[model samples]
Each structure stands twice: as C-alpha cells, then as structure tokens.
Target: MNAQTVLASSGDEFKAPGPELFEFPPLFAGGPEWLTKPVVFAVFGSLVVVVFFWSAFANPKLVPRGVQNLGEVGYMFVRDQIGRPFLGKNTDQWMPLLMSVFFLIWIWNIFAVVPIIQFPIASHIAFPAVLAASVYFIKIYLGIKHQGPVKYFTNMIPSGLPLPVYFLLVPIEYLSTFILAPFTHAVRLFANMFAGHTILAFFSLVGFWFLFEKPTVAGFSVGIIGVLVTIVMTAFELLIQFLQAFLFTMLAAMYIQSGLHAEH
Candidate 1:
C-alpha cells in the first residue's frame, strides 16, 4: 500500500507530503506527546537487533542452521569486512559494538520500507546524532586512554611541518577531527534516509493520486509511469539502505582504529 495516500483530501485536490510526514503526534489521544512513533520504533529496532542475535548465538551449535546460520553470516561479515581490516587484533573485542551498530541501522532503514510502519528511525537527526556522539566520545576516550592525554591531542597535529604552517593547519585538523567528524557522520545517514523516504512517498503518492483517486485520460499514463518508477526506486532504495548501514558501521570501526593508533 502507498504511504502517501492523500496529503489533504479537501475537495479532491492533491497535496504533497512534506516534513509533516516525518513528524507524528502521540499514538493515542492524551498520551505523552514525546511518545511518538519513531521513539517506539527506535526502541523496537534495538530489541529486534538484540533478539535476533541472542536467539542465534545463545545456543551452541557444532553446525550452524536457521537463524544461527544467518546470524553467523552477518556476524562474520562485520567481523571480517568491517572489524578485521581496520581493527586487526582488536576485531573480536569490538565485534559486539560493531555488530550492534550495523544490524541496528540496517533494521532501522528496513522499517522505512515496511508495510504500515514506514518511518525510518534514522531519518531524524536526533537518532543518528546520538549514535555518532557515542562514537565520538568513545573515540576521544580511547585516544586518551591509549595515548596519554597530552599526546592524544598533540598527535592530532602532525610533526615535521614548517612552524608557520602549524598555525593554520592545526586548528583545521583539530576541528575536522573533533567537531565536524561527528556532525558529518550523523548528517550523512540522516540526509540519505530522509531524502530517500521522501522520494519514495512522493512517487507512491503520485501513483495513487493519479491512478485511483483522480483517474483521467492523461493521468492514467502518468500514473503507470509513477508506479514503474516506484518499483525501480524501491529496489534502489533497498540497496541504499543496506549500503548506508554498512558505511556507517565501517566508519565507526575506522574511528575506533584511529583512536587505538594515533598515527591513523
């Protein structure tokens, strides 16, 4: 079913879905205003990640089968592709964190395409901002712990440069590493999911509005095109959802690696 059915159905005039689509009122009247759909789904997304892995790994198996097999494949992908390459010996140590981030994000994105509950949790900047901030702090903590406090901040500014260059380069590097890193990290995911969700709702709305809601001789052809585009865009969006999750997790691992090895 199309999510954007009628933006506003006054006199049969069509309206486009906007930022209002991302906002939700309380699920029930008199409920807490803050208890919105994305909040509930964010908690649900976390539980879904926890449950799937626990069910798969909580039991020992000589030969993997069912969700265990599926779980292992996902586990190994994060471990090998994401963790091992950058983290090296610290890979297994960080698997739990890396796996959680990857699967949780992938599932959150999946919610956008799900029936009825079609909101992407990460579409909201707050969601990704929190995750990115957690990583940012962890990166700072690990950097301080591994490389001494003085050394950690100092290492961020490279050596062997001309003294004059340090005045300009030092601030830029520090800002990029400390501030802009997390900002971009969160925005990248939020922007992609936000735009993708809006685009899907738009095409779906177009098809529904033209096809059944207000069918006409000329609009019939346009409706068909809208539907075909929706199908194609959906496929593209699914791939994007998975890729964004992987990229976010990969970058997290890279940040962790940088913390462990200041030279990074």
Candidate 2:
C-alpha cells in the first residue's frame, strides 16, 4: 500500500511528533537563562580563538614549529596576501585588525556546522551588521585622520567631473560607498548564512518527515532521497561558510584600502 494509506491505517499508533530539530525553549518562559546552546557556542568559539592564538604566539621559534607555524601562516596569509596588497606600507599597523576580523569570521562560520550548534551567529543580521559598522567607522576615522576633514569629503567625490555632474555624482558616490556599502557587506554575509541554514533545516526536516511521519515502503523510498539531498547540502554549506568568511574579510580590507588611498 502507499505511504499515505499506511499512515492513515496506522493512525495515532504511528503519529508521534518527530524529535525537535533546532529549537531551544526558553527556560521559565521569561527567565534570563544563562546557559543556552548559543551562549555555549559563542563561548566555545572565543576559547578556541584564545587558545589557538596563545599557542601560536606563546613561544615563538625561529624555524616556526607547532601552533606557531599555523599561526604564522594564517597571519601572513591575511597580512601579506590581503592587507599588504591593499594598505601597502601601512599594512603592519593594521595586522591586528585584519587578524581579528579573519579569525573571528572564520570561527563563526565554521561553528555553523558544529553539530550541536548548527545555527550560525553571523546568520543573525545584528552580528554581521555590527562588525560591518565597526569597519565603516574605522574607515571614516582613518580617512579623516590621514586626509583631514575638508579633503576627506572632497576625496570621496570623484575628480574630473563636470560641475553639473558633481551634484548628481556626489550624492550617488556618498550613498553608495559611505552609507550603503556597510549595510550591503553585513547583509551579504547574513543573508548567505541565513539562507544556507534555512535550506539545511528544510531538507533535514523533510528527511525526518519521510523517515518517520510517513513510515512505509514508498515513504522510505522518498525519505532516502531527502537524506541524500541533505548530505549534499551539508557539504555545500561547508564551502559557503568558508567563502562567506573570506569574502567578508577581503571586502573589509578593500574598504580600508579605499579609505587609505581615497586621495589617489
């Protein structure tokens, strides 16, 4: 018989709700619960960063051994490959900033697939938005500090434009680079992760739905397909996680570069 017919025939005997997928009920409805999965994940991520850096920097070796080697590689990758290309001579001064951004983003992205903590913090708009705004403020501050207030504004507006075109171009440039850029940066990361997680959740739940909700020969057949799809999606999410982190960091560096060379 078809899965539906079997399910109908089984009725309440096989109608138990499936296990919870990805929800955490608030303790006491309104209580300020200190111990939650998200809190744990955040703390864990922080610890991972701290330990890794500590191990990498605690005992520096000339030849670079153990965690030191890993740390140096990561630092150099961001500093040399990313920061230096953009900031040039000023790259060293910005190493800390770039390193922090790179590691924090990488950890957050990786944690999305960390079994128990399947949710990505960056998927929440607030987190990425705050980070993007921080970079935005830094860019503006650096621009003013290096170029002065009068020149900073002037530098932002493109040169060699017709007098009449200045009116139209100025507003467009201001809004695009200064106002909209940061929002887009944050949204780009947030939306990608959010959509990725949502798709994962959907497929996962669908797999469970077929496996248990409609437990029959036909149901099992379709359910197995869902399982395969879920596996593929999980792998895709892993790639996306790394890509999003790298893109966010690279764009941040590019923004800093723009601010540094706005007068050029």
Candidate 3:
C-alpha cells in the first residue's frame, strides 16, 4: 500500500496519546524503532560539531581570526565562568569534557531550525541519558581518585547532621544525587526539546492542513492563525534551544563542582 493509505489504516498505531504532540510514524517520529530520525540527526550533529571545532582551532593564529575567535570566546566562557570556579586546581583536566558537553548540546539544539534537517537530537531520551551517565561516571571517578572508596561515600553525606537524621538524609541524598539525578537531568533536556519540537510540528502541520484540506473562508482564516502561532512557537523554540544548552552545561559543571567539594 501507499504511504497515506498505510497511515490511514493504522489509525490506532499512529495516534498520539494524551499530550504527546507527535505520534510514531513517518520514520522521523520519536519511537523505539531501529532507525529513527533523531538518532540519525544525532550522528550527523556530532560530525558537524567535530568538523566545525577542528576547522576553527586546527591552525591557530596568534592574532585572532574569524571562526577561531568566536570559538575561543565560547571556550573562554565555559572555562572562566563554569569550569574554573568549580574545578579550581583541576580545571584544566576537566575542561575537555565540559567543552564537549556544551558544544554537542548547542549544536544538537540549533539543528531544530536549519532547513532540511529539522529535528533536535537532544529531544531523544537516549542521547541525553548517555551524556548524563558520562558526567556521573566522571564524578564518581573523581570522588574515588581524590578520596578512597570508603571515604567517598562517607564524604558524600554531611557530617554535622544528627545520627537519626543521617539515617533518613543519607539514603535520600544518595538516591537523589546518585541514582535519580542523572536520569532526571537527561530527561529534563530531552523532555523540553521533545515537547517544544512537538508543539512546533503540531502548529505547522495544522496550518498546512487547514490551508489544503478544506480551502474555505473560515479555513483560510484558521490557517493564517495556525501559521502565526507556528512562527511564534518557532521563535520561542530558538530561545529554548540556547537556554537548554546553557542550562545543561551549567548543571554539568555544577555536578562536577559538587563532586569536587564533596569533602567540604
């Protein structure tokens, strides 16, 4: 059968439940399928980030130049604002990881607007989950490296609290910081991107649907409204794109900071 016929037949399969704006279909739909658009977009996004940075920084000029200057400013922002404050003595060691997270996230979010490839990879849960896990692993490793295994866990919990309070607070703190925190961190970025993209998709599709599907006086008016809403949502998504990337990097740096200062 043709594409439209298949979609029409599988109404139940394609229908999105509740507030989920986009249903799984059209290959690009965020789903458990083998080759989703988000996954492909993520792979391309990684390459783009790598190539862009490499081209910008490969042949460094003593005097600042085009892309290199812009890149240096970004690096300096993270180093001076985020890494140096938290990492202090060991800032240089962790700079690469922090920079990677920031750029990867920023590139992925920016892809939401670029012409043909319109999906943001960070919208996928798996991508952010992996990033969060990476940061968590690094934090744990740092903790172990600085203070031995026994002391690491001990240092994690605050010392001044009473014994009874320790019993409740310790586990809660551990579970929150160690267990639940990473997943939530990943999901926060994913959910925001996913929801934002879905809204844009809904408005854009509805606008076109009204323009073509009916072609009446009221339909024309509704189509115009939908188009306007889509434009507004697109503008909002642009802001969110930058904000989410900044927030993700900021939180990652904070998490690293927490690990560094766990002893105090």
Question: Candidate 1's residue-wise lDDT over 1-264, tens digit each?
Answer: 232333332236667789998989998999998899999999999999999999999995999999999999999899989999999999999999999999999999999989978988999999999999998898889999999899999998878989999999989998999889999999999999999999999999989878988876556766888899999999999999999999999999999998988863
Model 2 poorest ten-residue lDDT run: 12-21
Residues 103-217 of candidate 2 have per-residue lDDT tens digits of: 8877987877787677887876767888999999988888888888889888877688789998898899889887799989999998898888778777776578778765666
Query: Which model scores highest in lDDT?
Result: 1
Model 2: residue 143 alpha-carbon error in angstroms: 0.1
In candidate 1 the C-alpha lDDT for residue 104 amounts to 95
lDDT of each: 0.90, 0.79, 0.78
The candidate with the higher TM-score, 1 or 2, is 1
User: Which residue pairs in model 1 clash with each other?
Assistant: none
Candidate 3 has its poorest 10 consecutive residues by lDDT at 12-21
Error of 3 at 70 (Å): 2.0
Off by over 4 Å in 1: 1-12
Candidate 2's displacement at residue 73, Å, is: 2.3
TM for every model, in the order presented, reads 0.94, 0.85, 0.84
